[model samples]
Target: MLFSFSLPFFLSLFSAAQQGPAAAPARVQPSAKIEWRPDRPLTWEDFRSRPATDQLAALTSSSIDAKVGCVDYVFSAQVRAVFVPTESWVRDPKRATPQLLRHEQVHFDLTEVHARLLRQKLSLVKLDCEKLQPAFNNITKMAFLTWQREEARYDQETNHGLNLPRQQAWEQQTQQRLQQLEAFALK
Candidate 1:
């Protein structure tokens, strides 16, 4: 299973002040989600959650949400890359540097690249309802595994944004990948 950052219970309480008692009891308040965009980059202010550990400078909670549907035997899927601010946090805001923020942003960007890849793969799937769910599951599982591996490799190579040269190289490569997958970007 993917490492998810969603915390609906705490989020509901955190947002209780903003939402009155009239809020639906059965429905969990959705946490803050920011869709990946070329123009919008992450910042220290975007890290809203309290730090959970001193071991890491920062944590970026990003994932790709994929949905599939079938109508009249035609199957389709929609994929979105999202960053959850409520679940992302920094060990020390004052200590958080621009380089660190850029690194976190790259993580989100990588999620987008993976989302695009999932979308591209889903687009090519044959319209067979009998096999659609299994196909979707297999494709998404592979993508998620690949995404996690890439993330680990990036963090290791850049040393969590401490290595400026490696960080820059990753940033450049990520940008190129985003451009290459521009055709599959969320509309």
Candidate 2:
């Protein structure tokens, strides 16, 4: 009788021992849905043709709603060309082919979602205009920094040796600031 009672406890203990520290929490899925529209490709020409305000508006409106989070998110890419290492190295390394463009578009989509989330959180905080201004500025700066880091990382990893450590550091710092902003917003 005692053996039978001890068996279940022993098995429970064994199972607990077998399990490793809970797997590092699963990464948060990008809180956005990406939709690639082959018909509409954003080009330098396309961007240049529009007024600055219009360009910003277009970028903002490109986001689609996320089903899971009920939040607006954009995550799609439209590739126009490929990155040729030899040609890229000689001239403008910043130039992107269709595939790179697509990859970048996805990054933009994620950045947009992150920005939107931050904005929503800020509004929830209901700070006075004067008090909110600094926070808002910080959020904007952080978001841009994050976007630039992401873009540079993508470029470096995809292209040959475009490593910008300064950008990486900026990204890390901005991301940390963003987290603090998020926590503050939530409160």
Candidate 3:
């Protein structure tokens, strides 16, 4: 008998200024989704959502999407890092300085970092079909938790881009890690 199964796991990381929540913004149709590309950096135009009436400077909605499958005895997975511009917002164009945008870019890059990390961990999977589901769940769940912590740590350390030195340090660190994991990155 031949057996095969595939499942997808999605983990989203919301990066925003630390502040109390306000009234929800209106919903609008997303124009086009942006996937992570080293050559392509984000711009103010990429933030399409209506800014909330709060102290938030911006919000970035990024996620890791993974699909793992087992066919017969072989296992495979596909992973991607994605950015939703329509869901991301900036409070004001005048305040959308280059530094702030760089901080937000790091948020997206961090999502890609975790995606690569998950891909790296998943690459080590070697199990029978019966063990695939449970193992995959455990790995992905742990990765998601770790990702959350990293995001929080980043915001805390950089103070939402207010700390220029820390933010620059994080930018360099993030770039280094991304390059280190380039082997696991999606083509």
Candidate 4:
């Protein structure tokens, strides 16, 4: 995602003082990111590398950015998903078990869901450059709020994917929702 996140960095942003016009914030470190893959589910092996010894667990994040243009009466926006491994990381390898991997996988899957939703909406509605930014912003805001709420609910409902029955429910729900939005799935 064009958005940057790391437990420490995100947390630090909260603690650090606001920057004034004269104070440009320090540069953020680059994170190693992977694109969301439909064929491959995450595995424990994927959590091997830890960028920093931050006092927190992993955080999965996604975002959408689109380019809009028009020709005569036709309007089009190409929406895409951005996943960043830079901000996403494992706090402790030992704690990264199969269940944890599944939890992380769900986060990525939710991202794909938003991407598909955006695609479906774009296909049905036309927005020229004049109306592009606001339209894209509105959609992105909705997707982001949904992603945040669902992620929290997933953790709460499943106890961070620790509860077997609850975790399965979230998994099935995510799968079903993905299927419902299959028409706009990524290529």
Candidate 5:
């Protein structure tokens, strides 16, 4: 009787084992929905109508370094894309695709967010030039590094090369650095 009872238990266990572990609940990835405000797309005229000061402010505030007072700081829609000869071998320069524009726009937007956060931190900490200068320099460096990464990704995507690895590495590094900076700034 004991053997008979144990046999059924073993058989049930074996059957369950054959069925394998319960399936993991399906995971839904969040969608990245980018809303394009201008239906006509960004144009040279659109850039020119904006005040130079406002344009500089936008760029500077985005965590990008642009001398606001300088004439070169002006935004020009004509400058649709950025290219580096060193990475040209990996990407085609002739491919001035809309996706490239969108990629640059992401950089621009990220710069703005970084700049705003830095300023807020500076104010919160009551930092003077002497104290804030180093932090400012570090943030600038980080922005440039991020810019380079995005540019490389643009090239990779445009050339039909796999950039997932590079993108993931960048995302990890950026998140780590941002967290470190936030911690220091908060203190």
Candidate 6:
């Protein structure tokens, strides 16, 4: 069970953040950010309030805490999705149902989708110590922009999960997208 940082209610622009700045720009321990798993869909119980974000509904961001490194000309890095229970509260516990959960999940799903794309792109990249950070930053920047754009499109197309038909459509679209990027899912 986990609450998340993906907010459709508010549209914030994320660049190579990118990683979220809503929370303080503290250094995140790799262990702190949970990696998104194909088997897991967020549940309401996961939305605990202790580490709350400033009253937002959902937030989806990635921590490529892994800096690009090359040993013997081989490049490697670690990238994962980190879900923090910020900006989550059941408006009506009774009404805070799967319908809404699905919407929130989409927010995180969108983030994971970008993460996959990042992984795919990063996999092919060759790194040299001198050029590593800039190249990595470029990948991060592109992924982050795509993430923000997709978030907006999701909210507009689905009406923040208010329109069931549109919501369903988004679900199908995202699921298909996930399938297309399955090869890049983190191990």
What would the per-residue lDDT of candidate 3 be over residues 1-187, giving only the tens digit for each residue?
2322222222122234434333333343467767788977877677788765465777777777777777776788877887787778877655456777778889889888988998888778675676777777778788888888888889888888888899999999999999999998888
Q: What tens-digit string does per-residue lDDT give for candidate 2 at 1-187?
A: 0000000000000001111121112222233222323233333222212223311111212221221111133111111111111111111113323332333334333343344454454445443443444544465455445545654454445332123354354445545645554532212
Clashes of 4: 5
lDDT, ranked from best to worst = 3, 1, 6, 4, 2, 5
Show the lowest summed lDDT stretch of 10 residues, model 2. Answer: 5-14
Candidate 3's C-alpha runs over 4 A off are 1-29
Clashes of each: 0, 5, 0, 5, 2, 15
Best by lDDT: 3
**Candidate 4 wrong stretches, greater than 4 Å:** 1-32, 44-55, 71-73
Clashing pairs in 3: none
In candidate 5 the C-alpha lDDT for residue 137 amounts to: 44
**Candidate numbers, best TM-score first, in rank order:** 1, 3, 6, 4, 2, 5
What's the residue-level lDDT of 51 in candidate 4?
46
**Model 6: C-alpha RMSD to truth?**
9.7
lDDT tens readout by residue for model 4, 85-183:
455555544545555656677777776777677678778766555676676667666666765676677777886666779978888898998899877
Q: Per-model C-alpha lDDT, please?
A: 0.70, 0.30, 0.73, 0.57, 0.29, 0.58
- Which of the two candidates, 2 or 6, achieves a greater lDDT against the reference? 6
**Per-model RMSD to reference:** 9.7, 22.9, 6.4, 10.7, 25.3, 9.7
Give lDDT tens digits, candidate 1, residues 1-187. 1112221111110101111122111221247687788877777667778877656667788878777877777676778888788888766665455666677888888888888998888787674776666666777788888888888888878877767799899999999999999999877
Provide the global lDDT of candidate 2 against the true structure: 0.30
